[model samples]
Target: MAARKIHTLIVGAGQAGIAMSEHLSAVQLPHLVLEKARIAEAWRSHRWDSLVANGPAWHDRFPGLAFPDTDPDAFVAKDKVADYFEAYAAQIKAPVRCGVEVLKVERGPGGRGFRIDTTDGLYEADNVVVATGAFQKPLIPQVIPADAGFLQLHSSQYRNPDQLPDGGVLVVGAGSSGVQIADELNQAGRKVYLAVGPHDRPPRSYRGRDFVWWLGVLGKWDLQTPAAGAEHVTIAVSGAQGGRTIDFRRLAGEGITLVGRSGAYQNGHMAFADDLARNLDRGDANYLSLLREADAYIARHGLDLPPEPEAHVIIADPECVSRPVRDLDLRAAGIGTVIWAVGFERDYSWLEVDAFDAAGKPVHQRGVSKEPGIYFLGLPWQSRRGSSFIWGVWYDARHVADQIVTQGRYTAYDQSARARQAAPESAIHAAAGDPDGPYPHPHL
Candidate 1:
């Protein structure tokens, strides 16, 4: 006889999974969370020791829990954040099977539910949620020449400055991670170079208030409404601002050298783009101008704001090489480390659903997909500003969880086989290009 089927199966056991589990328990929904590793694996394994969330602690809590800290503006370190997740999972007694990797999911035969095959075992569920976040894949550009002799590592593998070779270090991305790592390494007495890019810029503090406070004030943290339709659009556009995050202006003001986008490794020296330094300087100027404009607008709106804070307190070291990689030979120059602070990519090979549109993202309004009993969370822009953050997932999770309870009951999803058969072939045909195309079409 076939094994008993589960009611719901949620992929991943991180913050998003916990949020979904909390809601499922409240509604007494039968479900289980499948995690390939221990809970908070990414936080535990990938992040550096001194790393704290760029956002404040209060803004980092998941659903149904709060981060206890005397200083609201305090940055919660990586280990602490990991512990918080573990505690949250334990507190809720979330139904999770750790170390269980889900390899595939497909529509069940007869359309009753779904067939989920994992590394550990196989199971079926009426509904499934791919809560795995977009960070599953690390992205590196192929444009960089392969012959660059320097050792290159993604930020994921970086723990501290001690791993660098005897020579200087070159960081290839100037995003939040890149900037922070560059600062840390530079402080550790290693020669560091930062490659700058166009990133969102905000102040460390604005009007004597933490950046997160403005987010709350701006209703960026509001999640009472189910994010669907236009509300979703509003959230995306607003959140893309990175919550007006604090930039590295203060650091740069202290004399850190910033370069441009392109870099090549040659005889022991890293060569940067011809326009890298100039572009970086221009970008920095543009960023300051934008902030000043916002400040001016605030004053114009008759807002009683305190005097503007002085510019940044720290600056990077100035004793840096000037030539680009093409001009300098990296191997001969003995540059030991190359840090790829490049961004992440989204991978969804395990999901066996027809919901994804072009570019391999599930087509969902809010968290619900066109396929019944299917949902997603922790996406880059699931609904609003906080969708991807720990705190943000709570709102999206609650909405998606409630949706599952309301639409995922056994009776609600009990489509009759005959009715499913009579349905048009259009639905299944649309999935033809999908790797898990609805072959033997299970319609119910």
Candidate 2:
């Protein structure tokens, strides 16, 4: 069958895809957004029921659409976030096809464009934009024993305390997701064990203003490098009850047992690292660094702002920090549930292109792929540290759309020589699905 040709074909109808569609529409470009599931599927299905956006509503607005003035400072709930995307799509009349999953994307005939094989049908596009945001796949360490007799769940599958078994729960990785889930489980009368990892514990509010406001004012949000923004660790804060800080020490005091990083699980025994104090110290250092930078920025700008508030005192138990459990028997400890909040993996296996790096990550500068007529949006550090967030998509999307408009339509062979010269054989092999390649399927 003949493929339906399009000027630009965008994959994933999440925030990034929707934002890209809006920009393309503004420029009067012909484009269509194809989503594997419904629009905002991740927010609607993947997130927990009680999950609220880590950022406030005011900071979550996309281009040409602002959150209703009802509660700009409020943290939008999962359902509300999905609704916002739906409403934005309606308002913009975005051309989005939900439930259309792209199975594979390869060089089109004669390398003139891309041939996209989707569940519905084939699509030929002069240009293609991958707008699938970060966090494509849930990452569970391989060290976790599959036979470990416990109800294991990743943060993506965890919904509420009631959904878990009626027993103690061990929440691994003390990032935003881990801490929040631990807090919720503890509040629901479940004995909670939090495996603390290296994480930032920034205050929810500083100097009578939300921390987000400080980040924006201090130019933290504008940081181009991921290193400067401390993108490694998730921001530990909550939007529940307006906004509140998430302190490990506070959770520990509230009867939540804190352990060190997880190591391995074998023979019904889970091993944990004994670097809790060191990790906490590192997090404290990062927090101080950010505060100092913010303070310096305020002084440099000579902005009239209130003095920084005193740091909150969180008393930690020495026993909790010193006690080392090299191996823990889950069944003996009565821990029936294990929640892995470790991290996420990005997958671009469907994209058959030579514009990937040794790590299987796309090689792009400010959202424009090295390969002509291809682009990526909504990736962390794609252009700025905020690139993966809702508020950040607009900037990257606009840049990508502009690139498409400037480059016009062309075949892949036009730049095949340059791509071959620039990209390594390993990247090409990985993209072409060489079984012996460094990056195999299901991971990338």
lDDT leader? 2
- Which prediction has the highest TM-score against the true structure? 2
Candidate 1 residue-wise lDDT, 148-249, digit = tens: 555778888888887666777777777667777787787787766677654544454566655556556555455544434433211101111223443444
Q: After superposition, how far is residue 363 of candidate 2 from its true place, in Å?
A: 1.4
The local distance difference test score of each candidate is 0.68, 0.82
Per-residue lDDT, model 1, residue 28, is 85
- Residue-by-residue lDDT tens digits, candidate 2, 1-444: 888999999998889999999999988999999998999999999987799988888887785777775487889888888888989999999999988999999888897789999999999998899988778899877775667668889999999988997899999988778888999899999998889877777778765668888778777788888665456776676776577877676687788888888887777778888888887777777677767777787789887878865663435545687675667887888899999998789798988888799898889899898887788988888887777789888888888887787675232333544675689988676656745433222212
Task: Report how far off residue 95 is in candidate 1 (Å).
Answer: 0.9
What is candidate 1's CA lDDT for residue 259?
61
